[model samples]
Target: MSDHKQNPLSREMKTHAMILGSFVAIFWVTELLDMSIFRGRLDRFGIIPHSLVGLRGILFAPFLHGNLAHLIGNTIPFVVLGWLVMLQETSDFWIVTFLTMIIGGFGVWFFGAPGSVHIGASILIFGYLGFLLLRGYFQRNFASICLSVIVGVLYGGLVFGVLPGRPGISWQGHLFGFLGGVVAAKLITNEKRFYS
Candidate 1:
């Protein structure tokens, strides 16, 4: 009956939640190891603009952070927005995340100042924010439109992060990460859900 139908959906939700939680857990664990065993040296793996050696950082940067404060600041939004993206379709999370890292990381690598390293999950965060905010406009679905409005109202101030002027901050990552999200939104459209 109704209970049988709900059970499968509930189990799927749990699986999606676990996947999202595991990703955040990896961030925390990476930070802990970097702080204790690596003694902050792990940050060198972060994206360094225009250098061949720095190119490897494009794969590593999002997992690295400058300090506890930086990591903490990024964790909440990463979890919340990340969860929101998964709610529509769990696979979108992987697609959006991969796109953000590649597109956003390349932006930092190409434009980031010499001798500077850019790191942190904020790039993915801004990318998620961008995807969530714009997905509705592209899909023209009522639920997505409503979700976009809520995301905007709750996280609107993040728009300022895209602008240049924050010393030591990679506005390039923010700008391009957001663009990456828009690209994700354009590329992936949600399949119709039974519940919706």
Candidate 2:
């Protein structure tokens, strides 16, 4: 009889995979519901600059998308980058995600153009990008540096999204989400150093 004991790292990876999968599922499900039952009206839940009512969008915006194409655009990068963020420590995923949501969402609310509503998972996607790109520099460790290099090589082009070039894209979301990721990396690395 062959034994089938799973290793700790394998278990951790599975857990991380499930978490990422569930989030992606939610994104798809929400979009489906909005398109079919809600008639795209759910998009109004997205951040509206300078409106107290819009403050709630910070919590809902990431789950809402402008369209099927928009959601599809965000799904792949979200899975890839999100997996990378979890590789070092699964908890880092939660921390980075939380920080990015709060910081990125608030940035949109405060500085976004008036009369515009921002919605999509791109904010979180950009946050993951920022974290991975800078985690190496902040941690200053061999493994982290290697991971950062790999990520930069693969996703460096995404940095241009932060600039104000696209007509309908939310550059503010990208910029602030990225900054939020940088902040998350700094805080996490600092905490590790302090503890170690």
Candidate 3:
């Protein structure tokens, strides 16, 4: 009953270009607004220590940010890593991103150091990076592995980004995002031998 032959490319499948472009544009817009006057309230709705007790910040934390620097920093990796995931597997890319956000967000709230409130896209960044790393290994694509290592190196500084006392920062969120990426990468995709 279904005509796979006649399905419009746009309707049937999303391309890497579309996925990457959308993330770039959306992040740009979000960053611009973050630089605007509403900057002070970034964490107002972000995942807070108290949020876990209430179980409300899981969905909202990933969307919140502390400042332009924070938003832009996370966006760069997100666009790159998200593009990789989008390019590799279309079916579960969005699902993976969403899952990373929820799980990462909740993880931070629950496990982060006490009195620490979290914000920003660190979870998504790490999630994308994590998937790309594992998927690359499973696929045994030399190019993919190299790319992942490069990204890993670039974002390695993120570990420090998760620490406190930096002023207007939410390092805990970064930690959660990183952990979320690893967990999701291992759980979502089946571990397999090198394909090529």
Instruction: State the C-alpha lDDT per candidate.
Output: 0.89, 0.94, 0.64
Put down candidate 3 lDDT per residue, 50-148, tens digits, no spaces.
544434567656666666676777776777677666654565567667767877777777776566666666677766666665555544577657766
The top-ranked prediction according to TM-score is 2
Instruction: Give the higher-lDDT candidate: 1 or 2.
Output: 2
Clashes of each: 0, 0, 2
Ranking of all predicted structures according to TM-score, beginning with the best and ending with the worst:
2, 1, 3
The number of residue pairs in model 1 that clash at the backbone is: 0
TM-score of 3: 0.69
- Candidates sorted by lDDT, best first: 2, 1, 3
Weakest ten-residue segment in model 2 by summed lDDT: 1-10
For model 2, how does the per-residue alpha-carbon lDDT over 48-165 read when each residue is reduced to its tens digit? 9899999998989999999999999999999999999999899999999999989999999999999899999999999999999999999999999999999999999999999998
Query: lDDT for model 2, on a 0 to 1 scale?
Result: 0.94
Candidate with best lDDT: 2
Q: What's the true lDDT of residue 15 in model 3?
A: 67
